[model samples]
Target chain A: MKNLFISAALVVSALSVSSCKKDDKDTTPTETTGTVELNMAHRWGMGADNFLLNMELVHPMTQDTMTFTTFKYYVSNIKFKKADGSWYVHPESYFLVDLATAGSEILSIPNVPTGEYTDMEYTMGVDSLRNVSGAQSGALAVANNMFWSWNSGYIMVKAEGTSPNSGSGSFAFHLGGFMGSNNVVTVKTVNFAGNSLTVTGGHTSEVHMTVNPAKLWHSSASLATTSSLMMPGATAKTMATDFYGGIAFDHIHE
Target chain B: MVVSLLITSTNNNHSPLFDRGDFFQNMRTILFIVAISAFLFSCKKAEIENYKEWGFEKPSHFPEPHYKFENNTQTYDRFDLGRELFYDPILSLDSTISCAKCHAQTHGFADHNVNFSLGVNNTVGKRNSPALSNLAWYPNFMWDGGINHIETFSFAPITNPLEMHETMTNVVAKLNASAHYKEKFKKAYGSETVTDQKLLKALAQFMAMMISAESKYDNYVLGKTTFTSAEENGLQLFKTHCASCHTEPLTSSFGFANNGLDSDFTNDLGRGLVTQDPNDNGKFRIPSLRNVALTYPYMHDGRFFTLNQVLDHYSNGIVQSSTLATSLGTGFNFTTQEKQDLITFLNTLTDQNYLANPFLSEKKK
Candidate 1:
């Protein structure tokens, strides 16, 4: 009985010693790190109505009554600027925000250093480097159907819907380009309006941002004029610009 | 560890002699643990062997390859798997058209003397299948520079409606179902589960190694041989007339150019369709002249049947267009002798070694 008790004690001590060694070997001191969740609240039109798939919604600008079946886009290369003029760039920050998946709307950026961020910067489309690079996994995987199989570039923004105003009875706009003269990749920065976002360790903070889908046709023609855009070009440039430009930071929740 | 614990518990029972049944049970447990650990250790060794770095020989004269295998490290096993996939028709919807169906190893990896290759169900395609040699050096793929990466290049043909017409998801499922492929995948990727990334990377591994830098022209350039006087004259003519677009050594800029193929540009917008730039209408990627002799049915649409016809098109048949190449506006006014000499020089680019390279050929079962 004494031998068994001694053996058990030795085993327990060995396990505890190994675990302590592991904690000491960690690359980053975990106590000072916190997670920042950027909750992208998507809405339809200018009225900020709830954006739901398979729901009929009248366009605020075009006045074209439409029922959206699919809406998804890529948001990547997230960076937060500190009050000290230094930037904390998130590594491998690529997210495919699909309307069908509720959790995809909330992009959780973990391991952020505990600090006050004055501005946030993000790219609306997948960067040119990743588009040219071969065979990406996770959100950038080809299984997601966001990538063009033939052209080999990400469809930065995809909006498919049915409309009575079109001759084909449907509209599909897949906008993307990542090369010179044809690039639609946009980088936008939001100033936080003098309110610094303080990320405390062990506490999750949310940065709420609003997206307006109606801005896609803001300066472009109605669905009746052109219902489909499978490849990137002039119409894609205008539509993607308007839509990407419309994304704005609303407020932050501590 | 469990066997030792069991032995300790049995010893603690204080029996005068060890129970034969308990002893046998403990032996069996020890054997099982040994077997499991041995299997796990072998798996770890296999994984290390799978990722073992293999060097690819790049010719001294040639430029650096566009694909450096950053994500998918090169291994012989992965390359072999890619070769198997390239020749296998299992990736197709009906299990008929593999990548090799359109891209044969012979004839410089282009279709066999056909203007446009037939796909699954004998369905004719719109564009001529381009040669597949020296792809590692190509900045972009296809005649329009549509595909950007060598790894993702197979996805176009595999999923194209007129090509293999199979979805990536379905391909993965089919590969998973095959015990032969499962074993191959396990050997290559350390997992029997197949993925689109693995499949594409494997294909890229095989494709990236299809180098064609041993042509007679290459020999002449490297001072290993001498070009005939006529061939030399033709080379000079080519340098003065065509080297701007069809750059030297590589014989391709891999950039889109409006070579005056069409004046209307209505039927197929070509690169313009991809770029959406009005100025880019009637533009197509300049093809490599590495094995131009074998990869006949030339041009994007394979409009020209013979090299003579191609030369004729350059000499007198250039159509005027708004987006016409500035150099090609006035055609190359060459005499019949000059044309013959140029054709001779072009023929010297036929790399017989590349055409009959046993390494790139279909692996016979």
Candidate 2:
């Protein structure tokens, strides 16, 4: 028991040291630059309930009983606007926001020169360039299973779940199209509601966003009518537009 | 992980190397030994593996390749790993079919005497497996040119239910599970973890080395050999009739064309499905005709089994369509003698060296 206590104390010390290292990383920002984190707080429809996976929920619009098994989407090409009309573009800004994967909602934007940022610009789906750039790593890796093999394009947004109201007893919607008239990739700008986020050195500022997953069916039919949409077309574009449009910048916690 | 060990050894920690003092010193010695052995093991492995030094060389006759092996730099080991992966059936869901099942080495890396190659469970595919050669020169892949990257080409077939019937995740998992594959991947990519990107890049490396440039026609172009009268006549005929689409040297411009295949394209929209343009209906990529004699069963659908049938289609069997190649007006009026001469010219394009390249063949267990 005494040895066990000692070992436990060692583990606790190690954990605390590791956590302190992370705290240092976040707090002790470089003199010239600071980190800005975009926290995507996922929510349901008009009721504003927490949107989570593997939990039974009723669709606000479709009135269909649904349980999402997987909900993954791509958010990329982050850009921040300065007070002087100049924008700081993040290079290689790509992220796969998976509901099942913890902490994926936080998009960390690093190496921003300390300044007053007026607006946040980000892409809802992967950029057209990355979709055509072939095999990628990190969030865009093929292992993520977010790419269409035969047709050659990334699945911009995917929502797989089970629903009792569906004709097939399951729902799978993969929305993506990066080329031509049917392209579903949208570049959305969040102007912080006319407010400015002041970023100073040795600090981390956050832009909290509200992403409504239920907005996909805001303008579409119920699960019984259309349970699955696996490819790109008019239906995918509509669903993507609805979902992407629902994502709004609520406020900034500086 | 290996990187950390390397950094530790290269650091200022040498007192324990020559000491047998305590557990800490012993731990340091073990780490040093492990790092040294790892370095020596890799060196020994490389020394034992008798592979030709790899550098993607575009043939002097051919123009600069479209994919000049950027992003996917090739070494001999990477090519070797790719060759193994290509021949291994592990890419298939059931381990019953491999890329080599459809793309045989002897048949210019196309299916062997079959229009549609069998996949897992003997399920057949729709389109013919096009011969893979000089792929480093191809800017786009597949019949419809939907795939634009060489690194991502294998994903199409590996995941196609009518082909390998495997998911990229499962394939990577299976590769990661196997000790042989893990070691191969480690030797090739510096990590035991097998990823889709690494797998695809390795395959691309092997493809970059598949240079088919030593044919009789290539010799003729180089002024090393003189073509027969029939070959010369056939070359002239090909230039006049087919050069606009199936351009010279590479024998393809890599553009899409309807080619008068059909009037109605409801079954297969071809390039139209990718672009969503009605004008591109029934249009397929203009395939390279390198080793045309060996790569029989021509066209995207493998409708023609022989060069004669292909020639016949060009001569008389032109199915008129709104999206048909405007260059291919009605049909050509080639006689039997001219067809024979064209066949001779195509036969001269069969590079014997490319077919029997020992480096590309499967490594025996």
Candidate 3:
């Protein structure tokens, strides 16, 4: 029993030594770290109404009647700007925010060092590096049906639904391109606006960000015009930019 | 025969039996793990003691591999699992087409003279199915070089509409549903729940082992055999004319080249579709000339059925294009004797041992 206890202690120490070398190293073990949840409160355009699947709604911009069956996109490379002027960069940070999956909208950043953060930054879609890196696990796994197989790259933003405006009676917008001329991968930043987040130990801070799905057709045409986009191009870039650009940081709960 | 002797001599101690000797030496340290395994009732000891026997090892002549087995480490269980998956039709939507259907071992891992391989539900594919060997050494995969990694290569065929026409989610679900696959996955990765990464990594494990370095040319390179006068002259002529893009040792630099296959780029843009660069419009992957004799109907579209026809194309049939490879300058205009000699040299690249290796073949149920 004594030897077992000693062995268990040894195992714990070994695990600590190994985990210290892991890629998800934003803070050291000794540092007092706090968790931050970027609660993606999905909303519609213009009036910012409730955005839920299976619910029929008219697009504020395109005015196209649509009922979404699936809406999923990638959020990756989360970072926090420290008050002292440095950045707390999280490593291997990737999340698939799917409307159907429970708790997927909450982008959780754990083990963030306790500090006053003035800004939060994240890539709207997956980075080009992870897209070309091959088979991945967790939120970036191919099993999630987010990654494109034929032409390599993540399907950065996918919005599929049954629409009356569609010729096929259904629409699927799979937007992604991490290459030259057509790259839609853009890094977005949200300023606290002097309402800085106090990330303290033992308390989980939540940041509510309103995501307008209707903005996908803001600059682009209605579903009646271009019903589907399977691959990335100018149309994919325009629609993705509109939706990603319109995302606003609503509020924060300390 | 000499190739197997050299490889065995170099890696004789990599057998699983060697681990047993290390086991007794480190028994005191790993006693806790053993006790825990006993408590869990899963004795992994029965799992092949050595997968390192089939671990990725570069040929003495070849350059360093591009895929250094980054995440998916070499293991027998993984290779076996991959082999099963490679030959299994469950990857297709209706379970009709397997990877082996297109890439067969007897034909140097290429289809048997089929220009375009038939896929699931009698769907004919677009591009000619290319031969696969020494894949670990390849920088990129497919004729277009679109797939950047070998681990992700299987995904393209599985999800392609004209190919397997299956979703990754559905494939994973199918794998999880199979008790045989679940057991295989458990033995390979210690997990009953099979994920796409595991599925891909397992396939890569089998593919990475598809090294074809036992050909007569390899033997000649290793100083184990001699080439005839025609083969020797052909080798020198090849070095002077074709060795720039179709480089030595691996027989390919794995670079993209518009080998003057076509003048117009309206139908298939080839590499341009992936890069979105019009300059790369007609360029396709300059394929390895290894096993060129068996991998016919040749070229990206299987345009040439015979080696002589391919030679004639390179010598007399090169079309003019902006993206044409600067290396291929208006046909070689090879003499009849020179063409015969070159074909003879190409025939020496057929690795019969690699083609007939029992380990790579599908396990009979």
Candidate 4:
């Protein structure tokens, strides 16, 4: 009877130890960290065509044949929302996405806490505070040629291309505004549908987003009518809004 | 909690009767003490650093400066570098025109009595170069208040086709190529990389220190000296007529106003071009009266050659415009005596100490 009691106690202790180990294993992954990369895919036309710099492409709406030489825009204030309603804000989150550079499309946000993120939010332009604040580094640097020297504001979107339809044989649209009625800063948020983004330890998760350049001329006139815009105005407002609205989250690779 | 848990688990085999709760409580107390000490140490360090750094000198009588130096911390090395860059002609496209070429120190930092200052390759600018003093007090920069920050103000002349006419990228490249500039940059900033931020901030550090608070007017206001009877009378008249727009102490109200400079806005829209509102047509930033005597050829287009002309414009030369300030009803009906008194009072604003401060002048390499 004593021997039987000893065996039962050993079995109970073993069960308890095994259960504790399982609990430890379950909790360890919650402390893991990983990086999340935002891949912005740019396309030229409404049909989701490849956006190659210096490649000739015809706009579906304007029907103007154009070859883009330079296309760059500011993307900033990136934030990720976890499943538990907490947010992870990327520090100094500013990027100048230029079409000329191949790797510029991928914005790798490192040191993100491991968790299942439900939504991602980002701004289409540099914030007004940074615009008013003097001098900035990284992507918002003046060397990027995305800053307006005269007006003291960022050129949030720049699209320069050569078109046969244009009067000057080229078109340049520099869109930006920070304050008052003509402000063009746009904030966009996208949910991952029902698919939760699982970020594992030392793993890289990618969120792919599609950007349509043709949407810039969605509500505006053809390049033939108005080719050059060096300042912010009503036409810039319409074009920037259309382009910002067209950006959508496509998929996430966890 | 994790440390305590690990300790308890590690000792579980050695001691079966170990008091896990007591161990955890003791560990928590120790951690609390350590964290408190660390926080206190950091706070003390921060306070010492703040006191050690050179801060903005705020006179008791003056209002708080508009620029708080939020990002750019003021330092002696940074200011020295900025002074060198301000006097360097390498910032220009042709390396012939420095900022000092237009904004000379002797002429109250305004161009040398020129209505329109010339830029690189003898390119003439549209408007007069304003005096660069007490810029830290300015809410916005330029005649139209287009440039919001003082750091960004340099970008206008540097890139303007009629000014320095140099791209920021090209300027950076040139600075990078120079071994001397690289060494200066290394001394100012920790690294040798001459970025736009470093360049602008260093310039801002030098410009922010261009305070002109030692004028005769400032002395009189501070009870260090007394104003003459004519000057005192002019001050009273100025209060009644001009003080609303050109506020006292700092001299100008930094707000946009159309002082009836023109009836038509076709030539230059002034503030209208920036705001894009037709109502703001012909409106320009109120010119500061500090060192007004030295900074001649005033107004946005430098149409007025002297203080007398400016006074004449206010007294009689105010053209009818829709955006004209309501204060300038017809004109200030100033007699010759009143004009002379106002001019005498205005002369007291010239800070001779600031102009010849030697600190603001070009360093003799």
Candidate 5:
């Protein structure tokens, strides 16, 4: 009888151990999160199609006769708001958009927590404080030739090269200053037309945005009269306003 | 708890004792496991190092740094890279000049016995090579306050026809060709392709680490050392006369004001060129007083070779201009004894440790 009792106890203990092992094996795989890719196409005026970098013609907008030698600007603080009113901010958000390069078109927004989004927002230029402050890294790296060494500030929008339209042999206008009246940093917002984007597990979304370079001349003076702007002044302010006004939301694909 | 568990188990082994002793032992084991797991998790925490890194060593009494570690974080590798580039002649177009060629460490990082630095092809630069120290605290760079960001600072000297005379694109190509530079760039920027961005960042890492706030003046302020009677008197006089523009702590407000140097205003309208404002004509940024005793041939033109000449400029040579600093409305009248005392105080601003510090000097390859 004692042996029978010992055997029954052992069976009970064995069952308990088996149940513990079963609990440890509950590895139901969670769904893998996906990412959204932002494809930005820089455009210019109504008929203008291409962006000119160092006098090289590249079709980006549709058709434009603008020949540029230097074109560089900073885009930062990208955030997308969901229909549920939650925000997905891209961490360490900084990007130097140069029209001269093709590979730079794909602005990667990574490690976004899985969620649904409805709208997007971004800044046209670097914040004012960063321009005044000294030294920076990554997208704001001064070595990219986007910064002015003589006058302290990021050349927020550098458009230079020779143009017959311009009376002078060449032109260089580096418009940027984040302080007082000269602050050119512009924030842009685009609504997704009320369509909810499903950023769920195993999903990918692509958003297309359009930027116009001819907007730089919208309210500003003609290139014939004014050709040079290396510092912040009335000319820079006018040029920056016209350029920022040309930015528009293109479309979203999921 | 173990003993109690043993006693309880000794009394009743078959029926699985559920007493306080067993409960306590189980709780203790769980807590220990949790503690160890927490420690391991913290150890596994990953860090994403940025492209640039280097910082000033904070002393006990120093104020919050002016050039706060912004995007540039502090790291030992980046600092070493910057130190190497600082002493390397490869930055020059002809391999004949390096940063150390002009800013020698023995002279408090100021050029010794030369008014203007001789560049490639023996071309003379416009400005003197200023003493380079306590840079992490400086808000602006160059006498004209022309260069804004520290990362972009090297571009001026590197591309200046009278300096290194190397183009940024060409410099990147040259560095990319070198295997050693490729490895260094890979370590710092995670890439073998040497770009202008990485080159400037590495140079910044070196320049930003040049802090020189440990002079006798700094020591006196920190309460570590007491100044002599003459030094104290000189300090008081400096506060009354020179402290308005040449502020304390950093010893310069990083402003552009005409200090009565070039009254005729032929071409050197210091701050006026940047602003294009007539009021800023003939104005220049105030320089830091650190190592003022050694960085002779003073002023932007390097015309004054002695401290007394600089004092005389401040004393009887007050030039009237719209952009002249209000603090220098009237020239300072210092007696011979007072001049000597002021010079003595200025001598205390020289950081001997900075001049002789091996960390800032050329690192033996």
Candidate 6:
């Protein structure tokens, strides 16, 4: 009995010592920090007055007089390619660009990781996953007026108003689709002139891009023939294709 | 040395008696609890299984579904939470009526023998309570085809004063008041405070997971069995006459069509209310025929009480209209045997498996 008691005591003493040691080990100090930001800017084609939707502009190519009053589209999934060749994607990233709002036109994303970024990438329209998923919040919120109440999809891009050639007084185009032939989600990439952006020791930088609205009508037939588009169809396809193709990397500001 | 020895002896004498065995046991228990807590917390991150993942499960012969599960990834937890909220009456104005009230599982999640369903305060709805199944495969919702996206679909029913009679703000407030709902919201969406966004997401999660691909017709298509001669002939007739508007697999094309309901607008403009175009004067969304046997009387106004009347309208009662479907330009002519056969074919869409599926039923806990 005495031997058994001694053995029990030793085991108890060992457990106590080991548990305390573990408790001390768990409290070890460490620091982990990273920064990421989304920088955005807007640019118009040659001799365009600050880019407003539906403002009458004489097309250089077709020489047709068209007045556009509304131009808006969704931009989401901002990401940066690191020097290590991996991408750091921003979560729940969505943006609505109304050419009317100057602030919205220049999207600034802050808190990006301090690293050397080789390239920047962004989506032109809402992803397919967000389209089918039910009600959303933040930039994708229904209150934003970008969402269609009756038809269950985001108006990824809305361009409306009237043209002189068209007989009708108005033209409205709400373009959006996330599946099959109508899927218009485009991913764009920008390499900093073969030079990497060095973000080190908590520094801020800007990635500038030039987006031209004129390209929206490149492949889309003249405004006189098809002046309005409200739903996903052949017209939406032509306009979306032309507009998405027009997005190019002008230069990096920082 | 003399002073240190004296101090040590005094300290030891004043201290209480200590047992190494008891001290270690307490430490071990505490350490074990901390370890378990850490493990559980780390496992709390949301995953694909957190939402009910429903893919297309239609039979081979059926056409590809319109609702392709596009952006909404399926998961188990999201579906479970959606199902819970669907049956819970906390979403209504008075906390009395729920979606399941009008749409019960026994009647293919439709109403109980009523053409127009009763909403909050016993108010009557404008249209009939259509069956709720195979919704994920539907391109459009409602009789007018007003709503476009599946995510924004719940707003119409929730905000319709004659329906739930509750705003999203009020529903979120009610959900936030209950500790049970808070707990559930945290489990499903990683938060305790319930918002309209989360509520809508959860509800959609439940509604979208409702797949109604299992039926007699589905079985026959899968080669599990063969259809009766009457059902087979009816299927052929449907392929020729009805399938254009009703479509297949999901049994609806989700487009606006005027089935010659009237030669002119009488009361409701249906799809015209949205477009405001004179051309869309009398169009309405084509209703799915998945559970047509149970979800009657037919049409947006519930005008027909029986299948024979509906067939009659298609056969000889088509009124001429500018926006009428081109298929019904003249009108179909069917005999007595053909009508009976079409009815039999409609019966083949009744999904007994879906009606009795325990997963869709009220969860006990």
Winner on TM-score (1 vs 6): 1
Considering only chain A, what is the TM-score of each predicted structure?
0.91, 0.87, 0.88, 0.87, 0.79, 0.78
Lowest summed lDDT across 10 adjacent residues in model 2 chain A is found at: A25-34
Better of 5 and 6 by DockQ: 5
The list of candidate 2 runs beyond 4 A from truth reads A1-34, A54-67, A81-89, A110-116, A162-169, A193-195, A198-204, A221-226, B1-54
Q: In model 4, what is the error at residue B63, expressed in angstroms?
A: 0.4
TM-score, per-candidate, Cα-based: 0.82, 0.82, 0.83, 0.85, 0.75, 0.59
| TM-score, chain B, predicted structure 2 | 0.85
Error of 6 at B144 (Å): 3.4
Q: Write the per-residue lDDT of candidate 1 for residues A37-152, one digit (tens) a residue.
A: 98988888777898889999998877899999999999999999999999999999999999988799999999888999999999999999999889888889887889998788
lDDT, each prediction: 0.88, 0.87, 0.88, 0.87, 0.76, 0.75
What residue pairs are clashing in model 1?
A: none
Ordered by DockQ, highest first, the candidates read: 1, 3, 4, 2, 5, 6
In candidate 2 chain B, where is summed lDDT lowest over 10 consecutive residues? B46-55
User: Which DockQ-derived CAPRI band holds candidate 4?
Assistant: medium
- The residue-by-residue lDDT of candidate 5 on B17-126, one tens digit each, is 46678767656655655666666565444221222322365665655666655666656666777888888878889988898999988777888778898999999987
Supply the global lDDT for candidate 4. 0.87
For each candidate, what's the DockQ? 0.57, 0.51, 0.56, 0.53, 0.30, 0.26
lDDT of 3 by residue, A32-129 (tens): 88899999988887787999999999998788999999999999999999998899999889999999998999988998989899999999998988
Residue B82, model 1, lDDT: 97
Candidate that would win on DockQ: 1
Q: Report the candidate with higher lDDT, 1 versus 5.
A: 1
Residue lDDT tens for model 6, A16-100:
9999998887565321223443434443555543555655676655555766777788889988888889877877789887767
What count of clashes does model 3 give? 0
TM-score of chain B, candidates 1 onward in order: 0.85, 0.85, 0.86, 0.84, 0.82, 0.81
Candidate 3 residue pairs in backbone clash? none
Docking class of 5: acceptable
Question: Which 10-residue span in candidate 5 chain B carries the lowest summed lDDT?
Answer: B46-55
